[model samples]
Target: MTKQKGKLGLTARIFIGMVLGFALGLALHGFAPDSSFTASCLTLFQIGGKLFVASLKMLVVPLVFVSLVCGTCSLSDPTKLGRLGVKAIGLYLITTALAITLAITLAVLVKPGIGLELHSDASFKASAAPSLADVITNLVPSNPIQAMAQGNMLQIIVFAVLFGVAIALSGKAGERIAKVFEDFNEVIMKLVTILMNLAPYGVFCLMAKLFADKGLDTLGSLGKYFFLVLGVLAIHAFISYPVLLKLLARLSPLMFLRKMRDTALFAFSTASSNATLPVTLETVTKKLGVNNSIASFTVPLGATINMDGTAIMQGVATVFIAQVYGIDLSLTDYLMVILTATLASVGTAGVPGVGLIMLAMVLNQVHLPVEGIGLIMGVDRLLDMTRTAVNVTGDAMVTLVVAKSEGELDEGRFNDPNAAKAEEEVHLPHGHA
Candidate 1:
């Protein structure tokens, strides 16, 4: 640990990368708007950023599968898994519902979309949402290999839980396999540590490419709507979550957020919960003092289903779209939008572009134009990044709550300011450099 003395922590370094990247991107965009050199630099930035995100994503499948299996079999009581699932899913849905409700109420009061004189020739074709029967049917995978290859998270979750239960019942053979899985999980976490050490460069490239491609101009045209969504996201992440954490789990929200800084930054830069899963898992378990048994299971499930931030966007967008087209929606319509958006979060789990797809389903249910999505698509990349941070925060919040309820949390480690200092620093052994 002496090797890391006086060195900047990973979180501080990542923050520096973000700030410098943003400044550099703005410089390139403002000064070299039409230069071929600028184009080349942007291309390199995009490639570097995508490569970093891909590296993180490469660990997701094995991390989720192996970690979940190990967590599952470690439980002495198989029935506790059922209880954990209930609490986790229940909390997720409740928060999602609350998110959309807060969004709609605020949107209706704030009127973010009124008096907008903008016109767009843009149109979007929304894919059909799956039926309830179809969603239930697809939960159990016929071929787990195909599920893993395709990164079908819900199916992988179901299979992992069932496989773990089977292993629990298999006596000594099960114990041997479980031990092997535990070792594999440790190896996978080490890989995560390796990737995290490289996160500053990755985050720099991602933010640089984003700002270089789509700068603040995108937010100018839809300033009111953009900021409204952003405000609600902030309120949810800062206010709503903390209140719930303080109330139900009786935990310190301040400490939780402090510990979550690195994970939140990762989520923001990558803008994909699945890609950020390894870091999130590490944060929840190592830094936040949650048991691996709980973190492994809930983090993956939350990534797949807990989309409070997306739900907030859907809520605000529904009201914004209705007002933009001069359509007056009644109270019942607003209530329906709330209900539809909340349920649709789970109904369309694991689908690509799920946020907009869920938004389309909400719009269709409320008789709004599905094409209205195109209007907000301009500013969505930035909002997507912000909302992803909120989404992962929700995941960890619920994980901590569940872990606490089950007497699985280490409050001492959580409260300690330097709980995971050694884990956070990346240092090579002597003479390696």
Candidate 2:
């Protein structure tokens, strides 16, 4: 492995790419609104951006399955998995509830949608949400292969955990298979490293296309909603997460935040938690010094279940939509919103357009017009990016706490400012190293 301390770190490079892409996109949107050159460049950016996102997603299934298997097999006491799951999921749910509560309180006080006249003609039709029974029944996959093929994370998680438990119970043969899984995990992580090295270009392309298509005019029209969502997201990331880390994990919140910059940037650029999984796993294990056993389990499960940021959006949007429609929500209605939104986080796991879908469920529960979804849909893309950053922050925070409680965390690495940067060095082949 060769360390290049003088070179710019990945976080700095990605940030630079984002700024340059935004400037370039803005220039084209302003000066060459309908030019063929702009269209061509935008097309190329779209292709690069899509390819990069697909590449990252391509790693999620194998990485999660293999890594989780390795982690489970490493356990000396199987009961510890039960304890770990309880702590991780409990922390995640608590944070989700807190996020939504904060968001609703802020949105109610600010009144972003009051006195605003948006087009009432816009209609939104929400898909039928599965009942709680359906959700629970569907968790156990009928076929693990089908689950993997469909990218059904909850089902895949169920299958992986059960399969891992089996492997752990099989004694000598289980140990041999576990060793093989460990090798697969190593290879998958190396693949993540290779893809991450390409993230600057991907982030640039994604941001350029995003800004080019949705210019400042769209943001201007929905400035209040935009800023409110952003403010809440910032509060959760900077304040909520840090306080939790300090109070529960007893680690330096500053160090944890410092290690998270690159991972958060990836989430913002991609705007998909599943797509950001590989980078998150790498960051949690290699940088934060969480053992792979705990990181593998907590991070993947958190991506599927913990959506504090999305919960925050739903809380704010529910209030904003109700205000826009001139409807007053009773205290009971607000309670229902909090309950629905918190449960919806797990209910909507692995579903596409998760934030909007959850918002629809909340609106329907409160007898609010579902069509009001259109009012906020225009700015959802921008807000989605910020919320995703918060979601991953929650994931990392929970991973640290779980790891610490289990005695699986390395405090030195957690406190090191240069931990992530040092780990980013490119490792060469055996002869070269």
Candidate 3:
């Protein structure tokens, strides 16, 4: 399909939206300072952005369950599923470990928390973390419908895989059911296409409201902690992921990043990996050329478990909090922090405010006061957005590596600049609602 006259691509449009939104937000914050009109505009911005985020999130559970069921049932060998799981989870753990270690090394060198007062009225009550046995037992949902209702991703994934595997084993009956699922998958993807067309506007509102309220002011007293987190996130995204892409998948990192622009923007705007899963899955299978079989399994699982960005934040925050309290961490303490933060990534999966909770766990491991979490909470919103972008990028990177290892990657589509360009600009048929 040819490009429509005078219309920008989705990536370009989203970028424009973000830039314009940022400018408008900063302008409002600087000039209005306090005004009824400004408040109204911010309110409108918030509503618009939230609606977009909700729309994206609306697709996640169904998309994951449906797409994964389709992908799993199509597999020719059931054992390949186990191998795929092993590779994806192993890579996730390694990258998360690397992320925290990098954060700690950078933080120790920068000393972002040095000389800062440990005083704060910011108290935090950490929710008790579940044991490994609980996490493992909870993986098998007793009621799949209840799991779906609760948006319990791990449970949904487990149920979908088993259902798909059963379909694969059911012979003629399996084939008929699988056909129905395949049809449903297409419908779900069309829904995704409809959502993608709305993304630029959604992205604009999200950026505008975010900057309007949060503009540059939250950095005071926490500037070092804030930027260090951002810096490590960038390194993880630009440096670390690229190296892995090149080394493991032998794919061009530049091409991967270029293809990832839209998904990364969506992840950053929404600050939820689950919300970004539809876009990420689309980009992987369509633009990046990972077979749906692998992309389907890996993307949703990665969304749940792959939190390199959060791990990085926890790492830096642990060191920062320890330093603020003048508690010098021994070498063993630093090692413990890395191990705890990495494992906590999986252990605390799907919890609300998981980054802080994981940081609290890490803090306790090193005997640092948990209340120090309040010191860095003020600046977390912006950093959360950036790190989420990093998290999704890591997900895609691992997906590519695993897909390539399994011989499921299509290098032609991956290498082509315009592989999914026209597909992204979906238009409804005339007279269609």
Candidate 3's C-alpha runs over 4 A off are 1-6, 348-352
**Candidate 3 local lDDT, 156-271, one digit each (tens):** 99999999999999999999999998998899888998898888898899888877887888898898899999999999999999999999989999999999999999888888
Candidate 1: where are CA atoms >4 Å away? 1-6, 347-353, 429-433
TM-score for each candidate, following the candidate numbering: 0.96, 0.96, 0.96
Error of 1 at 192 (Å): 0.6
lDDT of 2 at 254: 85
What is the lDDT for 417 in model 1?
A: 82
Query: Each candidate's lDDT (Cα)?
Result: 0.89, 0.88, 0.90
Local accuracy of candidate 1 as per-residue lDDT tens digits, 1-433: 6556447888998999899889889888888967999899999999999899999999999999999999998899988999999999999999999999999999999998899875546799888887657777999999999999999898999999899888889999999999999999999999899899899999999989888877678888799999999999999999999999999999999999999999999998888888989999999998889998899899999998899999999999999988888899999998898787777776655322568877888899988889999999989888888889999999999999999999999999889889988877656587765
Q: Which ten residues in a row have the lowest lDDT in candidate 3?
A: 345-354
List candidate 2 segments past 4 Å from native: 1-6, 350-352, 427-433
Model 2's alpha-carbon lDDT is 0.88
Per-residue lDDT over 329-361 for candidate 2, one digit per residue giving the tens place of the 0 to 100 score: 998999899988888888765323678987888
Better-scoring candidate (lDDT), 1 or 2: 1
